[model samples]
Target chain A: MSELTGLTLKAALEGLAAKRFSSEEITTAHLAAIDASSALNAYVVGTPEKALEMARASDARRASGQAGPLDGAPLGIKDLFCTEGVESTAGSMILRGFKPAYESTVTSQLWRDGAVMLGKLNMDEFAMGSSNETSAWGPVVNPWRQQGRNADLTPGGSSGGSAAAVAAELCLAATATDTGGSIRQPAAFTGTVGIKPTYGRCSRWGIVAFASSLDQAGPMARSVEDTAILLRSMAGHDPKDSTSIDAEVPDFASFCGRSVKGLRVGIPREYRVDGMPAEIDALWEQGIAWLKDAGCEIVDVTLPHTKYALPAYYIIAPAEASSNLARYDGMRYGLRVEGDNLTDTYEKSRAQGFGAEVKRRILIGTYVLSAGYYDAYYLKALKVRRRIADNFDQAWQTCDALLTPTAPSAAFALGDKSDDPLAMYLNDIFTVTVNLAGLPGMSVPAGLDAQGLPLGLQLIGRNLDEGTLFSLGSALEKAADFRARPAKWW
Target chain B: MAIDAATVRKVAKLARIAEPESRIEPLANELNGIISWIEQLNEVDTDGVEPMTTSVAMGLPMRDDVVTDGGDPAKVLGNAPRAEKSFFVVPKVVE
Candidate 1:
């Protein structure tokens, strides 16, 4: 029935409702695809039995005329989300065996909407690094390869698995988290559409914490409309998360294909960083042209504090991460190493449990938050963050939304930038500012690079304004018509 | 400022992460590059700027200050690495 696994979330829902296919049929198809595509290393765990059982129950409910919004849809869950009775590792050895008795608010909502859990996707440990290379479970290979090269490229991370799985057709769509481009960067690298909604749009109750202030859950899929539908179910005001905005969850999918006529789209001059690849700069122009063709007035805006965003993000994220990760002391759950005494055991377990990158961040976080350096590093970075957010507030005065390249470049070899942490951090240069500003940002695969790998254009919207971004993204999606799929090699 | 091996050891200790003497210098070198790069934030003149306290312009939403959860110890200690009668077992702190 039209290649069951190839259908988008929107198409799948239509198919399910029309009774062209049962939920069990689609769920089984996704399970088979995931079982065969292990080379991507996308999923940390696969729940075939659970998925089929849910699909059967979904079918029964649909037959009774009580279908939920996402009924019968098989989707991947990020390992960071605590699924009741399922192992939630957040891609670290420290939490290798930890399973939560409770479920994350986001996942619970997905299940309530009748979405099937195919499995838990992999991610960067504690969502620290830009690339998924920092994952203790090993790196997730990008499904898209360079034109003729056999070198393994990374699916941009900390939501690497989610992006790879979506691109490779392992599932309909996957849940993702963005703290400094975890969702967008990976989506850009994999030719998928992902949105990092405004901070506090989604409840952060049961997801593993990375940066408390910046972390937000969002959806990633092959199409903007799919992300829109998934985000509607994922986002809501949860009394569980204090920072969650107490606002009504709007019908996000209805915003897709909305007119962008007379909408002023901003192109920040500061985003034209020196030495950016010519193709990416060209792509930014192409996106602007497409939006202009869609009747959007293009305006050049300035964000003076743009360059300081990554630097400030590096400081603030790690500082919060160090605090969040301190709970993994080998006592409550996960791995434990014996030592001479309690403190020694704590130290030994942490040292052995954490990877090299995780340790580096923790040490940096500890140092910045330490007694002497707090004012110099952490406090100053916070001031810089305020300036960065102010930059967005000023831009919004002149434009409805801003457009830029999602990532600096297309996917690179897995080991290309992993060795140099700075090089890896630079991958999020285009994405970090949105998180710092607490704005909604989206990545839509607009075109391919010279190497035949897909590149994406990012849309930055004002806070609580993801609907406009969705409309703009759909316009770009229609104009560019980026329907290219990575060749099936895995 | 370049992070020294001594500072690395000190930070590691404060972080409660054990670092071997041999790994300290390498870790320091690795951290120094990142710290130096991040020090660029100092270039922005924020003399009177307030530190960003929250991402969104919203106050923390408060619920009724009653205990909403707990009372199930099995669920609480369900994933613990070592638990005894609902208590987490750890290395003895007292001699």
Candidate 2:
């Protein structure tokens, strides 16, 4: 790998500004790294030609002293975001060969800030699975493996490709989406930093929707500062998405070095679930001690509805997914299979288009929303959703932010939990409550597990209060000082 | 809320997915497992809680009833599976 590929997003920006390296050099290096690392299956499509063109333009702009904040930075976009004229498949066969005509609001913002797109990263089909095994292209392989084991492990999903690419130094950073732990869990699995901003912090226009009410876009990078820098460029209000909050985007980079003194961090008791690994518990204790040593107060807070979050999410997300996916019928765009009648055509197209997991979710969704079951399943889940949010709302009175584990365990081998849907859903137990409550949550790489894989600590902040999480995240990053990188096997 | 093969077939028809006769029983069993797992939500006491349709409490934003930026038919039909001129081609509905 080229040394330029190893530079952090922050370092790359400084290098571009200082004239130490031209934007073309950095872009070429990352493109080459991506080409060499194809075995990892991180990128679904590689845009080397477009990247070079963008790099040249960024260099010229820098020569004229008009460089944007992310000028010359090479980044990977998740396939979930629709890139204008690029084949944006949300990692499903249904959207195979469909090239979107318009750009997503999030990717357009990154380009406007002068970032170069290396390619579209892989993900779970429509951001549904906890592991990337659900992707049509293929599951992404984690760069890290156990000490003596050669079995391939998942990088986590639905942002698995983003996590793998960043961990393998294929890109400086990658854009990821989190409907429910999609961003944070993958980041934890890959030893990267990911933040799912408070609901509507970033516009959802043009991004593929999994669950409209729960979906949000965020960034994944190697460090807290890099994530903050990318997030500042990615977040803002857009009139196109009605759910977007018309709030001012803060300068997130400035909060990276801010003090955490006098801050009250909450430790939610419900996260300590049965059968959790010992290393995860120890890491949580270590995180608490780290915060306490940094002059912050730690308090035990209770989120009574946390246990019900997973069940509620499974209900609400699939219900919304069934509705959102209804647009993929064979007529307008994408794969089409003709049948004897229009309804048969719809059935054949969908049957051939979706994977098993997606089909299952759609079936569950249709069942729940069916006339006789709507009130019993869908409405009841909504009520539980309200209680989950209320628990978090009440916690804010006692603490500035809540701390917990990012996932139940470290990244497991591919196909380990694919057989059992409920076992797979349990992967998001610690992270889903934050999404249900519509708060900003982040995962910072904290320590390594007994098997030598990475473990992360999560911080849940109040709505529209991502600044506090950034401060606390950087503090934890400093204390953890986790510098281990996966050996180059790809 | 145990989903049986009959209910699974009903849902597959409603969802418009071509599930084979052989897959129905297995699909029903899998869905039943998930449904049983989610049935745990009924244990919670939600007496007067309002169903949350959205996370943020904001009214839907409306715009003036005027055309804004979509007129060309070629661009709209660019990705269509089958299109002639400005119209999408589908199987004949009226026979």
Residue-by-residue lDDT tens digits, candidate 2, A54-98 = 999999999999999999999999999999999999999999988
Residue-level lDDT tens digits of model 1 in A443-476: 9999999899999999999989999999999999
The best candidate by lDDT is 2
Question: Which docking class does model 1 fall in?
Answer: high
Local distance difference test, candidate 2 = 0.95
Worst 10 residues of 2 chain A by lDDT: A30-39
For model 2, what is the error of residue A5's alpha carbon versus the real structure, in angstroms, after optimal superposition? 0.7
TM-score of 1: 0.99
> Model 1 captures what fraction of native contacts?
0.97
Spell out the clash pairs found in candidate 2: none
Candidate 2 at residue B27, lDDT? 90
Query: What level of docking quality does candidate 2 show?
Result: high
